[model samples]
Target: MTSTPRSPHLPLPAAALLLAVLLTACGNQPAVPDWQANAHGAAERATAADLAGNDRVARQEWARARAEVARTGRPELLARVELMRCAVRLASLEGGDCPAFAPLRQDATAQEQAYADYLGGRLAPEQAALLPAAQRAAATGAVAASAMAEMADPLSRLVAAGAAVQAGRATPAVLALASDTAAAQGWSRPLRAWLRLRAEQARAAGDAPLAAQLERQIAIVETAGQPAR
Candidate 1:
């Protein structure tokens, strides 16, 4: 019986060199952190839940997003998380003192800056007032005109409408923006409620006809979720 010859093996050092080359060729990419992924995913889910009028679910998701981002120890990401946290709080009408967005101001994109500025104007007039008069005026004007509508999320739109009305700048366009938004988001509990509040604001502003019209629209939206007879 003859033994089969085996291929010659590399010496240990040579084998180690080859292994190192192979590993180096593999690129050794870092894995994405679970916390970062979870936070981003939660933030998206929270937005969807909010649009669907699922406040309970959205609230949970927003909290989870903030918590997950906190675990990542990334200050920039934390600022975004805080922005979302404040946005959600404003939605709940518990904005309390305006959130200081200055920490992220330098790093935020233009759109983010606009959103934060708009919210600051509404929730913390004093903070917004610190801006140059022209800039402060522009923020209120933009929100009042609903010029931010194209850039704003639905929740932001609701807040914008309230701010616009409060500023006595709820123009026809602003009213239309709010009316159309509530009509489109009829499923959203908060927006519908906001619409009702807007109707009252309209009445107080001496737009009786508009208030009546909005009240009727609110009635329709309220019945949308009910089981058909």
Candidate 2:
């Protein structure tokens, strides 16, 4: 939102009728789709609005992004877009099946489907081979927090940790790592979200003091990042 360099590591879902995939001229060949340009920041902008807890702006931006991706004429691109949404949600500590990816599954690439399974927490250890390298260890039930740290990109790291959480094999350390990662990135929305989640976990475990500490952390972030009313 503040335009402080949104990382462009991942590719985006394709847009309808807007095949802006750049091409290096090679005789008569078509231009290659610049996957990085197509993805990462665009749809993430939509979800980032949501992460900021702005419901109306989130809805508007999501619709706009979905409309843009609908023109890509590739189902896998759309499916991947949906995956981005689910990953962001997972990192935010929300729980649910990636319902949106189901419809696009019939047309998705095997790799995309495998990723869907990985994110859905239904992937088998053998299927880990099909996943992105950043996520392979997590899919195979490796130490999620450690694996998360191995990722150079902050978002990639969170996505891997989120997949581990979805897989139901995440340790308490996973959430802690997510919080630290968000804080280090100066992502207040996700920092607050992870802190609140940890606070809830502490409350359920009857650790009132720890819960209060976590709440204080959340308050600090929220106060500093207080959005314009």
Candidate 3:
């Protein structure tokens, strides 16, 4: 051969630098869209509108929240949150009295309490205890229904009485009806609130002993229902 063999050229560093540039470019590309963020923002705005006593805005936000929760597969949690949202709207409508809000809050609270009891292993015993009565009532057909209707009449009377009590025009009959309803409902928060109102009415009407008795009943119910704290 006339010439010496040529040395081979190595391009490893150049190839590595090219790969690094490509990777960096890919990493710097635009991010995907964030639907959740937008939905949440809409929810916040809706909440603000609700707080400002705008029912229309509140409803709009509820729809958005529902849609987002459906997409996210968290409908149960979202439903509870929606209850709080509704509660806020109701409070705004009622001039800041939570008790004056719609019954949705009470129903939601009952559900939440039931769930908590289940999680804490406290619901089984209660359910077991109630099963016998439930089964007996179920077997009674129209009789059970009639009894329930009869029971409901008293509750309705109590509700009416509670209204009168709030207006400072309650009588002994009204107080008795309210007390009975409260007891029958197992001192549920809503019922307890009614009982408190009745007690207030009693106090306003110069029946301190009755008011004290109602207060004691309320305390007992509250203590019994309270989660271990």
Q: Please, what are the lDDT tens digits per residue for candidate 2 over residues 1-229?
A: 1222221222322122121232233445554344534443456566667566666775676666566667667776677667667666666666536899899999876666777787678887677677666677666745657877777777666666667777777778988898898889776777887788788889999999999999989878877745766
Model 3 lDDT tens row, 1-229:
1222111211111122110111111244543224444455556666556534456876787677656655645444344444334333322222212221233334333443332222222333343222223222322222222332343333333323433333344455545555565466453543566567668878998999989988997787667635886
Global lDDT scores for all candidate models:
0.53, 0.66, 0.42
**lDDT for predicted candidate 3 compared with the true structure:** 0.42
Off by over 4 Å in 1: 1-31, 88-117, 122-146, 149-169, 185-187, 205-209
- TM values, all candidates: 0.59, 0.76, 0.31
Best by TM-score: 2
Clash pairs, model 3 backbone: none
C-alpha positional error of residue 229 in candidate 2 after TM-score superposition, expressed in Å: 15
**Which residue segments of model 3 deviate by more than 4 Å?**
1-155, 162-169, 227-229
**Model 1 lDDT tens row, 128-168:** 54432333443443444435365334555555554454444
Could you tell me how far off, in angstroms, the CA of residue 125 lies in candidate 1 after the best superposition?
12
